[model samples]
Target: MFQDKGALISLPAADIAKVRVPGSIFPAQELLALELREDLKAAVRLIKDICEDHGVDSLVVARPEMFTNGPTTAWLHNRIGGIEDHICISDGRTVRVVPGMTNHAFFMRLGVEKNFERFVKLQKRCPELIRGLASQINSAFTFPADASIPTVILQPAEGLMNLDPAFLPFCLVRHSVQATFDQIALSGKIDLTENFSRCSRLIYVPLSEIALQSEGFCRYIAREIAAAFFDPTVGVILALPTAETAESDMKAGIETLVEALRGIPGGIPSVASHRIVLASQECPESFLFQGSRRVELVLHNSLDAWLHPPEYYGRFDHIVVAASRATDTRELYVEYIDHLLGRRPEFYWLEHLALHPNDTGLIAAW
Candidate 1:
């Protein structure tokens, strides 16, 4: 069943079902011929066993998280904490089981130093690494060969772990494109198309701290780009605070987001509550509105505000455009990076962005 110059990339064969999955590449065709998830695992095992029974060396398995979860619907995001994926390697003498991280580690070998701070746009920042990650997952649930089982017992026994902070951010980044489109739908001021690529159109611009940042101008810039590239409907998602956010020594995060978002053309701004105290009792979807037309807030509660789940973040197309609202650029930059790293995305489809502290509303976004 082997051929030359095909999409399926095979590695050296090994004896006993011992399979070694490569990180960046995997056997996609072999898995898909089978239609069931559980059967998919069995097919993988069968292939490995066939190679092993033939006295082959071992099965090289390359995996990714995207395959397993890409088809997954927006839910509690099971990837948060549990065995989302796994690979079973069995040699005539033994079977070794491994989790998805093994594949991440595989890609990491050829991986570049990803300083999330430096990545202004997700894909623009690191596409190959990300693509490799997604491909692995796709390979996981590949269709099984015909006659595959239809039960969970045959699924790969990859032990799961609590979803990694890095995992959620990465997932959110994947959905960033969708979030942008959704933002347009919710704002209602723009008629944006649903098709968008994460980072392909959106870019993060971090700047120095400055008081009186005018987000109004920032929206104009984002609109100009959207109109020029895709459509005038192209919208921006920002996370900044009110300029008057008065906390000299301490950072006023939500307030800053309010200001940056306000800078956008027809952007609605709101305060994120703190200390388990909701700034409102509704989600941003309820309070956020187009222009000064404020909608009824549905999730201003302190608890939800504090949680600020990642799904909510994905519900809109926005950028992490921060203005320090700080008088000093140097100090603001330091605090800004610190906050970006400290705050992981509440949803799997969004990632933290690095914005400047001194940037005035519009100026900072640029």
Candidate 2:
């Protein structure tokens, strides 16, 4: 296994036994309060165990993106008590706050720009994901109280409709199917023009758009994408790096992708077994071979050329394209792929599921 200096102590599956907390203890008004209470207890226990085992006195907990100015901080403080002073909450940036301290005080004490510089330095030495996940397993217990944390929020330039052209062919296919069904109803005759037996799913990742984002954000997005459709059955096509893509960005993207794959429940072994098609000009050696596990990467020069003979013919049931915009070139590429596939793409609603709103809009625009 590839190891990072800041890696968290691995939480074994066998060790995570379910604790059945009685529902009667929780208020009847809140349906999930009991479950939430149990989960929090488990998280606190895990944190305490890890801290004791490492002989660590104070720790910084990275705030998850979801808990924006929520009651998580108060809830955690209630459970952990005076130790809240020892626990600092970070928003994956320069902003770090203790339990009672307001966001304004923290920023006023440490200037925004200076804090960012310090954060950059800290990031260079340690992986943010490790630090973040180590303290809080799934969700961060702390929430940003009053300060608006400046973080990059990547958004697709175009609406969902114009994002991927691969769905165009699928739309046409569906229209045809509907028309055929209408004809059959009118004439009372069955006409099977197309066979809807074998279907394939295409997961198109817009690498160019996500390349420049922070490594933490990249990992988050990669994990979300993988969780949604990282199966052997799905056909994934990651768009090639654009001219504006930086080498560091590509490296971060690749590393985060691998991390996301391995970070999932089953780890590298489960990911390595999946037959994923990575459509790119060249495959990076680091991505293909991570420690002892080898991932079989299928590379192609251009989307146009790759779809010429359609490697996995009549095998795609879903086509997922992760792009910021449907550029003319990208549209053409998707169109070509759709043409080759010769099937209607089933539209799966995936808006705002993978990428969430962030405060760093200006940075992302730049």
lDDT of 2 by residue, 73-98 (tens): 56644433334222222322333333
lDDT of 1 by residue, 102-166 (tens): 22211100001121112224324444433333122111111123312111111112211111110
Please list the C-alpha lDDT of all candidates, in the order they appear: 0.26, 0.28
Error (Å) of candidate 1 at residue 173 is 34
The parts of candidate 1 lying over 4 Å away from their true place are 1-122, 135-251, 261-366
Reference-based TM-score of each model: 0.19, 0.22
- Which 10 consecutive positions of candidate 1 have the poorest summed lDDT? 164-173
- Clashing residue pairs in all predictions, respectively, total 83, 17
For model 1, what is the alpha-carbon lDDT of residue 164? 14
